[model samples]
Target: MPQARRKTPFSGKAKKQQLQSKKQNKTLLMSTSSGTTSYDVVSVNYQPTRGRGGRDTNRYALKFYRETEEELKIKKEEALKELIPVPEKDLEVNPVDYFPADVSFPKRPPWDFNMTPAQLDAQEQRYFKNYIDSLQASEHWKKMSYFELNLETWRQLWRVLEMCDILLLIVDVRYAGMMFPPSLYSYIQAQKKDMILVLNKIDLVPSSVVAGWKQYLTTAYPALRVLYFTSCPAYNLRGVTSDKAGQSNEDFCETILEKADTSFYTHERYKSGVLSIGCVGQPNVGKSSLLNALMGRCVVSVSKTPGHTKHFQTIYLTPQVRLCDCPGLVFPSTVPRPIQILMGSYPIAQLREPYTTIRYLSERLDMPKLLRIEHPEGDDTWSPRDICDGWAKKKGYLTAKAARLDTYRAANSLLRMALDGRICLWLRPPGFAEHRDKYESCEEIKYIRWVQALTSDQEEQKSDVLTSESDDDRHSDDSDADDDSTDDSETAAIANKFAALAGDD
Candidate 1:
């Protein structure tokens, strides 16, 4: 330590310079070892071409001396790995975009009207010849089912519609408030063809309501010719049981025969030899049910679940009335998110509380009054459960344990009421009563209740006098002064006035 440190030749600046020299020498030695002479390597030059304004334009020139077979193979492999036809280095120009500046959009093909009277006689003769030739070549021709409204299905349906001789459009009266998809309806109208609008599920709604639905449809959709029908007629099933095979068979036969007789009277106009009827409607609107009822046999399977019918099935109803059952037509993806959630068709099932909708509908539709829920004290804040509990208590469904309300049973009772059509969710639009006097009437409600009772095996235990008294109490202030005097008139008149006061069912 006393000798003092001697100054070294490799100081801080010198050490850096020595390191940089070593790196350079190592690179040179490495290149030389690989037989790659720096002087033999080729160099590329970039140049710019002068324009009229003396501005230089960018361009590049590549110069190569020689490449080994291994290098060429490696380049080919690299190109193949990239899924390119050739190496990027070999490409001289960029691929041009093939998309046109003015691309023509697709248009709906025009309806083939070669057979229309407007065509020339010679053209008509030629069309007829071709038509007969095609028919002769085909194995068979059947009506298109309504289920083909999906994009893929619609194509096949359009083809069938083009070839068909007649189109029968079946509409549910219950869905009269919902508008038909314009594109589809317009296609039907463009055919300039006659369509028979079947007001199905008449047995579910009141006859007066059915009439109002029909009148509303007729006035709104003037292009469509409509007919009313209650596919299931009221039957006297006083002692019928599901276990009685023979009785059930007889009942089915009798029901069919009666329907056939009625059809002879009402559907006489559609008795032509080549009628093609296509049944369509929203899910669970009872499209398949009506078809099964009309067929008198299970030609198409019916289920309580909606969207069960996925394809169209065609059945012959006499040679003239060929019926085609389609999958229920729903607006492809236009169903409101909330409605879809409530209906349980949505994938996510966002519905946390369905009772909210039920309660709102109950209030808006005057459901408590419709079902005749009695609250002697005149309380207005009654919940849906309260109504259900009251109904259960009245119907004797009390629990034996704590004398608590049997709410689960009560809820079911409410569901049954809706299912039985005692509470109609859809109704005729406003101004309809003024233009058409076909608003729902009381006799119709009684008829619907009687039919529902027959089908569900639920007896009409509540006396008519009790129901009338309850109605009088509820609407006492609004009741007409001559109501008691009007009791002497026919039941139809009294029912009509009661229905008018009840609003649309």
Candidate 2:
């Protein structure tokens, strides 16, 4: 009942296209009957070869089976798709091995020019040029930001770089990006040293915020590894004691705990060991606190003042590892000095005109609302000075001479509030979610309070703004509907209302 299929020869058009494609390579390049080379023609003053033309003409007429041009092209495209090239795939995107897209160093610092200055200078010029050119060509260059070079202070940092095997770049979680110096990152990388970004004050922000920052940093710097820490551990919190981390820190804010033990596996630098890990960061970023946290006691002096540690020292962690504790330095930044002062990088007291900074802070933070200062003139508007004056009058901060409210004293108090985290102005690393993850599932006693606060802030910010139209609709609904009508399922509304009341109590 079955009929056998008959084989059919390829179409002539396909066969002809195939032969033409192969004519140059698989098919020999035929010559005309004369067999004259180009060299021979050149000797005779441009005599043409007739033999090449005749042989080619005969070869074109010969029949040959070959792959079609379209078929070959399709095969080539398929091959290319399978073999698409990309930058090397990094399997271990972890805290481990990675080749450096290393920031090459300045040939020689001006202070320490030992050899031919001209030679080093020339090399430096060339290296910087190449660095810029390469960056210009790369599509990823848009993601990078520029830095204000503070060459002088980094001298100490440079010395520290030479001495350490692993560099711990400590950053305060509240101001992680501000404290993280791209220049220092370049410098450490230039020295071919291993660096870990240690995010201190972990108890300040939520776990999801921490996770997002970790993810963001890891994305930007593929090799960057992160570890979270807090100087004020759950056990160390003074006066207010809760045998858990999640409840107490948020309840009492992240203030220092008096005379309490705190410990972590993080090491400090200096001394000869199998590995030398150094602690470095902007001042008040908890470099000294980090050391104390690791030691479980106050081995190193800790202060709110920046650069409290003035000298290089060592804290022996173990026989295998040593910590190099270097004094924190105020690195170069293009960010305004007032912002730096607000960031606690520069001393707030060392300023001449603080009015500009006060103005800057007021504009963003709704200072009047925060300070509960109202204008005496009975207007909605108030200048920074006016707000300061109102605050001064409220607090009875009188200038002794004129008996007027002391505006300067009020300003200082505002700055103190910001520094102490009362005002709650903070910078999160980029790509952080607007809606922080509900970390209620995280039952870690030490982390619960922060989670609660983070979630509460997010939820409050997410509430829908009631417009005039929406308010009218709500009123109409109230009049039209039954008084005991269910609002979002009866059980959920009751539970939510009850929870809110309990929280207030």
Candidate 3:
């Protein structure tokens, strides 16, 4: 530091050279306005003068144009105006008339008390959980919600649609017009949003009718792109034996994998990232079973009973394809008593008179004409009792007292028929005549007979087993020769009956 302080470049020529070098390194900024330009020099000065501590000092200045004081004030005022306070409103007071006289309402009776206390509790918990779960699923869609379309539900749905990327509109081919409202479809289209229309329960109708249904849908919903799926494909277990179960399983897996791969490969959405595929349908429509079939595994639980699946579960098919499985949506308070009975949610065993509901539905839906059963000679209109008696006599549903028709049992049988879709009440295709031949022919008599035979065989087998067990118990208690002989004879007769049924097959 002392050596530096000796004034190494005090000469005027050296000082002038140093100043010239500094000037060359400095920046010259230019500003132009109103067809005129002004120049300003920004300098970085190095001062060699030593301070009290013997340190060199340096200074830098950047020069540019300055606005007038009045202009600066105006600009600041404008900014302040732009930031004006957002207005706030006071909360409204609740009206006295809005309060209920009794704040607490009585709890509804338990629908499943036939089960054990613990079982009832568990079922109730599950039902409540499912109800809550259904509500929560509405979060997935902006414009569509599970509950009945009311002011509150509509508002919530609108909020959901506001944020949704795609809409999956599920239309039940059976109840097409009633299930999907025109306003809802119009609203979806107005948004210019992507939509995938799923024609659910294709298995319920004949494959031939599907073409006409598709055509009808296209005409009805020209904007919507439709996709077809049967919830339950006739489970094809051909060539699969007990010994080859493992091989058959592998083959099934490979088949599903190949189909999935092909679908993925051909799908434009898979190639270019797009919206997901969401599955939605009415109760017991086989949405869950279809998912399991498509996935080639038991990913979703499938039950013969309706309303088993009560939540929207999302499964990832690929990086781009996510399948959203939704709960079976039931229109609140709109489901009729007969429909509930058919769904197995209402137990037939618990009813005081099971046939009452069945008879009501039968007469209302005209089941006699549908079945093509001619009334006794001159009878114009058949009563439920007459139909039940006739059906019982024909089906051999007779009482032990005599060969007379057991109307009680006949009612049960008729209920089973209606539930199984063997007898169609309120059967009509969309945009067609009420009693069209195609709709009439939807009843597969052969398939119904097959199902009936199978059901009858199962019942016979159960009865035979019970009778054999009772006979065995009686023989175990008795050592008498006659009793033993009678038991043996009874067992042989049961075996013969089962053998005859098996031989028929």
Candidate 4:
């Protein structure tokens, strides 16, 4: 401070040289302090843009500062635009269009009882590899929905097919044609196994539709026997009384056994006299439910999830008759992915783009009317997105982050309802609408109507009994109340007499 030194302007190059010298001196001091003559020099040149790039934390902070909430929202919208499925032109497509004439499902590779477990596995692997390769070579493979890829699941099906004398192919009545694969029928025919085609969940559709489907399917394949089954038969189709439902289920089992008895028995397993009936179907098509209904108990676990049964399980219906259930397998088909999802072939939780599925269902069915969702824009026009938004609003579904309407959840819930048959989308067989009159007067319809009348009569009688019992209870209650009042008055007079005695004393 006493002697002012000459202040010199430091040039950038000079400053750099000075810093380098200082760093070198520091390194020398460190080497001296360690008392090592030969010390390795470590050079750390932080070229952020070279080799493994560094994170620009400061740049990101600056960018975040520049971006307002509106801008962030716009960016989010732009990102989400990539996930949205492009709308397709709605066309009048036939259900059979999904199954082309040339395409066939993979059959179990020929394995006699002679093959060892290892040999059988090797042969199956070879067959499945060839099947998948061939499918991939064709154009249809790209369009095919997800099928059973696990060898273990297919192995279960093969076991059931090999062991059972009678093959029961259960299909949901809503999409019976799609569910029933011709290749499966062909395989059954080749095996000489008696196959009974069961249109399960008949309660979802009208009786006329059921009869029509039965007629159409039986006519299509003369050897194929078609029977309608419902685990929880609706009151309109069958009486609500458990006794009546149990009787109907028992009769159903009896009819199947009788059919099995009449069928030409040729399998070695058939000689046991214990009828082995194997149930097979695509996933979530009521295979498990049908077995439980037939046994009049939950013999097998039932789930809405596709492929819930992981292995083939055998349950004895009677000492003479047994039912074998195979894990639900998804047979390869050209069915649209959206349609497959709608059919409950795909798991809802694993859905990548559920908006497309919602769109497909909305196009085919009056989803707005079915769900009773009002238009979000207060207009008649309702797109799938609009439908989802409206439903979210009505359901009060919101996101936790910013409390925005949760359209994804809304769409997913709607799909679940449709899959569970709460929102029915029954597909009529070909020529069903034209010959509706014939189907209405069909025997199946008559039988269902008769059952409905019987159920009504039973319900009326039950109500009468309940009313009479309630009336008796009311009378008894009144008599008890009168007795309590009489006892209270007698006690009160006794107390008054005691009080007068005390006053005299």
Question: Which one wins on lDDT?
Answer: 4
RMSD of each: 31.5, 31.0, 33.1, 25.0
**Model 1 CA lDDT for position 202:** 56
lDDT of 3: 0.41
- In candidate 1, residue 457 scores what lDDT? 24
Question: Sort by TM-score, best first: what order?
Answer: 4, 2, 1, 3
* Model 2 C-alpha lDDT per residue in residues 87-125, reported as the tens digit of each score: 212111221111113322232333333546456534444
Best by TM-score: 4
Off by over 4 Å in 2: 1-153, 233-272, 433-505
Ranking by lDDT: 4, 2, 3, 1
- Give the CA lDDT, 0 to 100, for residue 93 in model 1: 14
Indicate whether candidate 1 or candidate 4 has the larger lDDT.
4
* Candidate 4 per-residue C-alpha lDDT over 112-139 given as tens digits, one digit per residue, 9 for 90 to 100: 6677776875676677657765775677
Clashes of each: 3, 18, 3, 0
Candidate 4, 154: how far from true, in Å? 1.2
Candidate 1 TM-score, true structure as reference: 0.44
lDDT of 3 by residue, 276-394 (tens): 56565545555665565456455565653444443445565556666666544433222334444554333343333454455545544555544434453346656556666655554
Using TM-score as the yardstick, the better of models 1 and 4 is: 4
User: Model 3: residues >4 Å from true position, as ranges?
Assistant: 1-172, 183-192, 203-212, 231-274, 332-380, 396-409, 429-431, 434-505
Q: Which stretches of candidate 1 lie over 4 Å from their true place?
A: 1-164, 204-208, 233-275, 332-352, 369-379, 384-413, 436-505
Candidate 3 collision pairs: 142-160, 142-161, 143-161
Global lDDT of each model?
0.39, 0.48, 0.41, 0.59
Which whole-number lDDT from 0 to 100 does residue 33 have in model 1? 35
